[model samples]
Target: MNREKLMKMAGAVRTGGKGSMRRKKKAVHKTTTTDDKRLQSTLKRIGVNAIPAIEEVNIFKDDIVIQFLNPKVQASIAANTWVVSGSPQTKKLQDLLPGIINQLGPDNLDNLRRLAEQFQKQAPGEVATQEDDDEVPELVAGETFEAAANEAPSS
Candidate 1:
């Protein structure tokens, strides 16, 4: 009877091991929508009004670098959050922004331009545009906003 019980326990353990190994690995889809509600609300509070289609909010050991569709807008939010009187320790927070902005390569630039266009259409008064400026940047013939954004990634 003792030998039969030991054999049954071993078989059960083996069966469970096989089941655990069969579990599927989930795909990691990076987007801002998955961020915590408080973080999202804070971003909205600072005038980063558009929903970022693509975002990389990496929390390093010492700093949290949030890369979103619009680096400029994200920078503005950081400024507003950090520069206010009686605000919390912002020096470290401020340190992360420049590096984060520097990483806005070609793919991110295009994303920002697309986000800017959407914001322009949704909130005309709030979003800035080259067309709205007194002095617009010159573009060669057959050039476009998308093309300019797609030209080269920033360092």
Candidate 2:
């Protein structure tokens, strides 16, 4: 072939042939709009600032507790807004007893043990039951007060 034809062939080979002339398709990612993202952006505009030196966050909802360890916390006191972002672990009150006891320290535990012993001694075979209207009813684990009230016998 001619010099020009040879050069063209050489160029095609260098550029990985005719297939390389076509543009490669880009990867398409489907993006979804979420309420969380909107709320975050709004909060940012409102001057919400990150809270520093926060170790942990605990939110109690009735008998359930939501715990976050080493989480990002943001607050805007003027706006009365607080935001905590982290992987949450939900635990019942019974499950958190050990941690609560440890936090109470040995001194408080001893005092609590003494109080329990005294109470037991005072009422050996008698279980305490509330009769007054002001008294709160005993609730089972995972049972809400409203649910317990509904299950209770109507007077």
Give the winner by TM-score: 2
**Candidate 2, residue 66: how far the Cα is off, in Å:** 0.7
The global C-alpha lDDT for each of the candidates, from Candidate 1 onward, is: 0.54, 0.79
Candidate 2 lDDT tens digits, 1-155: 79999977657545365546644568987556677788889999988999988878878685698999999999999899899999999999668857767667788899868766756775667655555436764654798979988999998
- TM-scores vs. true structure, each candidate: 0.20, 0.45
Worst 10 residues of 2 by lDDT: 14-23
Compose the digit string of candidate 1's lDDT tens values, residues 48-85.
54333333343334334333322222335544552121
* Clashing pairs for predicted structure model 2, backbone only: none
Residue 116 accuracy (lDDT) in model 2: 64
RMSD of 2: 13.4
lDDT of 2: 0.79
